[model samples]
Target: MNTVTPVRFDNVNVGDALPALDLPPLSRLTLALYCGASGDHNPIHVDLDFAKEAGMPDVFAHGMLSMAWLGRALTDWVPQSALRDFNVRFAAITHVGESIRCTGTVTEKFEHDGERLVRVSLATTNEAGVQKLLGEAVLSLP
Candidate 1:
């Protein structure tokens, strides 16, 4: 498991960056467990043979699994009280043996129609520092 950020915020606004998250190398068992827990049965994520057949050298973690890590980071920073929208884009595949790091920086905070929205820039990368995915989130503040 990764350590959650200790940074706390009240009435967080745009242009604020959440603390970065770093985790140890991903374990095969962890990937298996995630597959079961998330109900994602893609063979490419579990069986290396199937992965090779699918043009990959070995099995990799699900894209959504990585996204879940990103979500965890966000939820930790914002808690459940002020968040109303969360979304991400999958940009590349992550193999089971690699470690992943999550990060995000707030980019915008504004209001329209009596609603307040905070836009954030986010991303994930491998241990080698290669960005595997990129995305953004619109957080509705309470």
Candidate 2:
């Protein structure tokens, strides 16, 4: 398993950019595996016929899948134990064959209840730069 170096509160500054994660293009197999692992089994994400019948051009990636990518990006930068709160809003659909890029920036840093904390703004965008997810995370750092 890959290990992440925990980010220290004192080392982070507002407006600092976290390392970006560029994921490979979303494939049909990836969608299928995600469906199985997530227990979503949503045909709209795996069945092209179902998606077409539903008026969509083709099967697309699940919203949670994209959000999960952003979460991975966050955890890749800091230890998972540092996360205190995480939330996201789905802004657009991610179509099959599209690559995603996850990025984050430290937005604020403060101390609360004797704990040092930082707020991070997160986003995921397609290769065309269309945003698919937007969110924030709060981390209690050592």
Q: Which candidate has the highest lDDT of all? A: 2
Cα RMSD for candidates in order: 3.4, 1.4
lDDT, candidates in the order shown: 0.78, 0.90
Tell me the lDDT of model 2 at 62: 93
Worst 10 residues of 1 by lDDT: 1-10
RMSD of candidate 2 to the true fold? 1.4
Residue-level lDDT tens digits of model 1 in 34-137: 88999998888888889888898878878888888888878767655556667777878887678899999988878767777777888999988888779887
For model 2 the local lDDT of residue 86 reads: 96
Q: What is the overall TM-score of model 2 with all chains considered together?
A: 0.95
Steric clashes per prediction: 0, 0
lDDT of 2 by residue, 44-140 (tens): 9999999999999999999999888888888788778888999999999999899999999999999898989999999999888998899999999
TM-score of each: 0.84, 0.95
Residue pairs that clash (backbone atoms under 3 angstroms), model 1:
none
Error of 2 at 64 (Å): 0.6
